[model samples]
Target: MKTIIKAPPRRKPQSAGATTNRPGNPATGKRLPYGLADCVIFLAIAIPLLIAMCATGRPGA
Candidate 1:
């Protein structure tokens, strides 16, 4: 009674002409501008929420 263990298959190499489907790695154009815009929008929404939370929690509103 011997158990035969099977090995997992290896991944295939990408072709030179194959397009990358991953984010933040566009084949053409820049990805940094969009990233910065996202950061700015996030901070804009977060700052007000934090300030409101602090204001409401204060003893003297």
Candidate 2:
């Protein structure tokens, strides 16, 4: 009976702050003005939907 040894797959080397290290990447670390603009736009759409749903909701249904 011959035993086969399977070696573990090698992993690629990652930099010290490659992933989720926001401070290392300024572009990803800080929120842009456009992000706030997008939030405002999303809120504008969401609030109206919420109000409409509330106003039209049936008591039992």
Candidate 3:
């Protein structure tokens, strides 16, 4: 006479809900890439800055 044995069951794959499991928000207070580094210096006068230039000729015309 002979004896019989049983086999174990296989495991199923992970579901969809288990994939997206994030903790918290990362971008709380982030700085810009070009923060004041890329600026421009504009010069008002061209040839000579005279005292007469201070007076607005038209006065906000």
Best by lDDT: 2
Backbone clash count, each prediction separately:
0, 0, 0
Ranking by lDDT: 2, 1, 3
Model 2 scores worst on lDDT over the 10 consecutive residues at 21-30
Q: Report the C-alpha lDDT of model 3 over 7-40, residue by residue, as the tens digit.
A: 7887787899877766577665666755353532
| TM-score of every model versus the real structure | 0.40, 0.44, 0.21
Off-target runs (Cα >4 Å) in candidate 2 are: 1-34
Please list the C-alpha lDDT of all candidates, in the order they appear: 0.84, 0.85, 0.56
On lDDT, who's better, 1 or 2?
A: 2
What lDDT tens digits, residue by residue, belong to model 1 across residues 23-61? 765656755556878999999999999999988895865
The predicted structure with the larger TM-score, 2 or 3, is 2
**Runs in model 1 lying further than 4 Å from the true structure:** 1-34, 58-61
